[model samples]
Target: MFECFLEIGFEAELNTKEDPELMEIAYEQCKENVATRATAITELRKMIFARGECHPLRTDDEYLLRFLRAREFIVPRAHKLMVRYCTFREQNKHLYEGVDLWGLVKVKDAYEGTMLDRPDTGRLSVFRFGRWDPNEFPVEDLVRAGMAMTEIGLRQPKLQILAGTVIVDLEGISYRHVATLTPTVAYQIVCLMGVAIPGRIKGVHIINYSWILNTFFYLFKKFIPQEAWQYIHFHGSDLKSLHKHLDLEVLPERYGGTYRGVSSFGIWLNKIKKYRDEQFDREMKQLGYVIKE
Candidate 1:
């Protein structure tokens, strides 16, 4: 449901100039255009796709590639603005309500490390929603949740060692965060850096589509061959909606723990393992991987 044009415009601006004044104006214009059109464009795309007519944007791969390309332009601009703004505020020692810019950079670095590449601007698009508000910040929630997972040792690689007693708090975190965090903490750190901090600190919405797409891409990049990159896509809705629709039954019984009538990380991890196993199995059937089972 994302638009390619806005992304293209943003990208064009990013590549066209280096002057701070021009960059700021171009970035603001692109941001405004994207923001103004986001909802309508998304809905239109969905409607067109739903009608079963050959939607111009047919696949998630195409959408993601275009989105990433566009973000490559816009994200740097946003990052620069964020850095400047945050520095100014910090220098004045003014109290800011939202996420910290330095925190976002750290998180983005961590995220890129986990993914082995810089996160595209599309991935950091959540910051455009509003002025960064710490109270509404998903980064804090994710950090807290992640810390909790670590505290309970649910984040450990081995699930069978511990029964299903570990509880995962799903409240106050976004679905995008859920997808990223459920992986290794390293991956979670990447997502946290790219999406969560920016969203909180900059008061930008940083479209959830970017997070979902990046998460899939990050996983695929790590576990699959480069030739197979086309298979990855953002699978679901924005973070909040994703959490709402999560199904617990798909996970392994060993990992499934009751948390508000749903599965915890204990269960979620099992599902991820199963997903990996299925992908591996498919790859083995087709390509015959050399690794010993």
Candidate 2:
């Protein structure tokens, strides 16, 4: 079975405005954007698992176990509101479910506990004030735990892939109200393998398009040195071929190609360039203040 969780959270510091019409429009727009992204994620998950036999009307013990494990990591600490849009299958039927997964948990306690217990989980723990804290009960951790539980579930061999977009309103204007506006979208996708053998599991693929975009951003920021940190947007269709390079080693297990010395050297050189440029900008900004006699 394939399962996915697409989450969206809003963080904004709006000025005191008395227009109720504008506020209503902003709220509705954000809701619609989130809903559309969630639907896109559901479609992507189905596409990845189309070859497998989907089960309907069956209890997902493995999924429940992973969910519980995730709860143990995030709840009782952060005190932040969380909503989950989950999709899964049982006996040839697709299931869609949503819940306020962290409603009962204390956020602050959970956040501190997760940071202290990082070694036990073998994952990093950190918080982003406005953005979603993926480290605190992230999808990656859930996939790892769920794959391990597949042995006990006796389910068919399958892979669950998740993909979605993150829309940031650049002008502080909600894109949902603009009718034709397309916000800068960042897509992330992860794949988890289903195994029938107990105590043996593998991560077939865990690819996110965001990485490629990051790589490009690094290169551009290093070589181009633009004044503003502009972002590159990607659509769902732009991520189709990310798995091609890893197909041999990840999927079917065969030799494809190899990287040489020059390629390695170039990668390091680019990283150094980017680091130096960033430092230069910081120093220049600090030096801008001066006293005149």
Candidate 3:
């Protein structure tokens, strides 16, 4: 059974929670080139499935629109990103194998506590990554866990086709943890977080990043393009400084803020673990390959 913790108001506008003007940056391009991009998305959807290697549901207008928003409505860029996302899934078979959801949790585990904690800021999906022991789980499982949450998050009303914020708490990560990010793994992560996923990722806050964190970001930086990379924010241990940008009330107790709900990580884990079966089925259908459950 899935034990839900916090219930957020998904109806809140991004303008109210975040800087109203900055919100335009996410969809300004789409608004400017609406007709052309929409047409291209329609055509590309048909072209992609023609090869008989895609999910019809993923090609739906609302679903594909998220990718367009992520790419600022640039058809080619959006198409390339979609293709890359599908390719990444194709390359990894373990994602669809036995107990992937629980496997991901047991290995690369985490959930969007930021959402449940701050119901008003549900649009900003924040996750804590300090506890993820990279030595036990490779980058593949990392991507699996991230993508699994993304899929589940989309089930929320407006989140289906909207971009959201991503906050990663980097408290306990060490040199050995950062060393695990190889070029291949780095590229995979960038594609998933930066390009592949439809969400605009209005901002990526790396809070509590330690001095040693710079080395990891240095290696991780090469894979991300400048435009998307520019949104990445580094906030050291200063909770007040980080709260200045991200609403202080939206944070958890660790950062000197309160959750106002069931503040247990296990409750958040169940929220994501419930989606494991659907994600595996999704991979099986998207790649045109069948995996016996």
Candidate 4:
């Protein structure tokens, strides 16, 4: 239904979904051309196989391109991120199970750090904060849930090539919230978000933020790479700025937008349903990962 609302007005500089011209721009900016893609794949495969393992998305042309574009098509950068993404999934089998299981979503639902529904025009995504129960779920669980959301986003053809945004709504974060964010954990999260995934982060908007939580900002600044940190925006409860940057065409009215009735979880469930249980199982098997849940 939101698709009915048009006249984007080049307001969104990165319109990967409808404009081949913009997509071409992304390819150029990322140095992602036909020749470079082929070369990267060849080099990436050789490196992956040398590690005595298989990359699940190795032969997936789209998957490789997404990574290449995310890393600006630099062979070394893309390969490093590619390997890290695949290997991390392989190593952390328990974090992600089959799509049928929906264990990650279940955990997120229980813990209250839920991923918001509907992506913006740029395919930017959002997740809720403040509702999270750290004692019950912890940062690792949040990361797992985030990964599952990323996987779901990546499966959608339009989103794979486009970058994403995350809006963290902080109602009243306290010292305990800051306590959970250490440099090491922050670094892992930064890597998972910035690289090691098909969905690259275009921006991270932290809204409804409390000044008291400033103590934890340093962890992100210190751990998250400088280049990546530039994308991080602290709205400090500025809804208008957040809405403008995200473009309300895609945001639900609840978040200061016009779009209405976007089911918080149903859209994601539909995407996951399209992915199917068996396909996820097969991918897990290829990665030599077991369904922990």
Candidate 5:
């Protein structure tokens, strides 16, 4: 288990001010407390070294806080999640092959269903899969694109604290698109969403549902865990129902909102591109990502 090692200097100074409302949510929902945060992070880091499995990881408080928040501050569960995250990365190295900020932004179509310009309650992120051209972009590229989005999302401290919501628009989905998701591929997607990623997904709103999607879910629900299933919702072309879960003001016109601007993938790509800086590049390298200049 200790084939390679990276020693992290664990520090006791883990105090960073957060909004009072968000702090309340973190304490009430995720068991996070400024008072005990340093202790929890220290314990989590110690467990990582003691287990000797999750080597070469980002042991900094900000990074470790993601897992702690995701697991509601349980050190053992956070440790398991960290191990699962590293294991998933190792086993599915192909999915992350070219997942870099600059490179990913160039793949314009990859951002089709994404809504990142502004966030809904708690930084809601959306992806519309119905518009994706499986013929032009392989499903593997879709996974890689999603990985890039997750990497960027992890960088936002507010997102980690408030958590996020996902909206999967299936407006024009076809059988051809559903066929691309093999059982193995579906399982991997589920693992990436439910297990690997160290962010809390409060709700997953599925709009524009079709029999095709219904049939697909019936077949693939086995791959989804029970807890994740609770988050799954079906809106079926009713924007009103979707609005109940997310803010109608934040949704684009296509989703029956008043916002009159293009929310295309390219726009989001450029937005996140401008978000990069020296610190962003260093953090990406720490996570073992290659940044294409």
Candidate 6:
């Protein structure tokens, strides 16, 4: 039944195929073209190999293009992102230990939703902090799960080209949830979403906001980059305000939209199982992700 929704708009966009329209978007927004793309990827590869670290790196055009697109085909910026990405993995090796979707099923608070049916936007991914049980699952595990999902999403050209948005629902957040975010973890999170990954996040909408959420933000505001912080919009239980940025039809009823369907991680897990091949495993391994049995 959930697959029906997947079939509607999400499934088709999950592939690597590049449509003419999306290609135009890429060219206009990211300056991507045959000549520029070749040059950028080559420059990025040269920079990456010059580091003499990040061994077993996948320097193929497809893999390198991700960073190039993320940085709008700017070789230097893309190279920096690749370095920071590798550095993040090296510093937080524990997060990748045995991190896979199957292992992350217990993390029930987050799920990827479909993009707006409109052709203008990419996708919207939602994370519900209020539904998270910190005691049942460690914050580290939650971060790991999030990283796994992001890696999977990045495989699609649609996501890379069109970019995406994130919704952080903070309705039921409590002090206990806030306490779990140590200063170190807060910094790591800021770096993870803000810089390390190639995800072209268009915006992040924070709805159902409460003072507890504000307290968390206040304590960690210094860690957040100014540009990224600017992208964050807080709507305190005001779905009307949230709808101004996003179409109401695309949002689920829980977010004050008319859509009555439920968003489930299980549906996403099933959909992404196709990515659990030998090649995907190798890619993860090369990126320093430990694939636990």
Number of the top lDDT candidate: 6
Which regions of candidate 2 deviate over 4 angstroms? 1-64, 71-74, 77-251, 255-293
Please write out the lDDT profile of model 5 over residues 243-276, one tens digit for every residue.
Answer: 8876666566778766443334555556545545
Off by over 4 Å in 5: 1-21, 98-100, 106-120, 259-262
Report the backbone clash tally of model 4: 1
For model 6, the local distance difference test gives 0.72
Clashes of 1: 22
Worst 10 contiguous positions by lDDT, candidate 6: 112-121
Error of 6 at 104 (Å): 0.6
Those runs of model 4 whose alpha carbons end farther than 4 Å from true positions after fitting are 1-31, 34-36, 47-62, 86-94, 97-101, 107-121, 261-277, 285-293
Tens-digit per-residue lDDT, 63-173, candidate 1: 322222222324333333234333433332212223232222222211110100111111111111122233444444334333222212211111101111111212233
Inter-residue clash pairs, candidate 5:
113-128
TM-score of each: 0.19, 0.17, 0.69, 0.72, 0.83, 0.88
Q: Give the lDDT of residue 217 in candidate 1.
A: 40
lDDT scores for all predictions?
Answer: 0.28, 0.22, 0.57, 0.58, 0.69, 0.72
lDDT of 6 by residue, 4-121 (tens): 7645544453465556677878887667896667877888788878876564257888888888888889888888888888888778878775555466767764554654533344
lDDT of 3 by residue, 1-293 (tens): 11222333222211112233433443443342444756867866776677555443466665676666656666667777677767666665455434345444553235454444222333555555567766666656666666655654544324533456677777777876777777777676676575665655667778877677778777778878878767787778777777777675666566666654322234444443343355445643453433333
Rank candidates by lDDT, best first: 6, 5, 4, 3, 1, 2
Residue 201's C-alpha lDDT in candidate 3?
Answer: 63
| Lowest lDDT block of 10, candidate 5 | 4-13
Show pairs that collide, candidate 6. Answer: none
For residue 204, what is the lDDT in candidate 3? Answer: 79
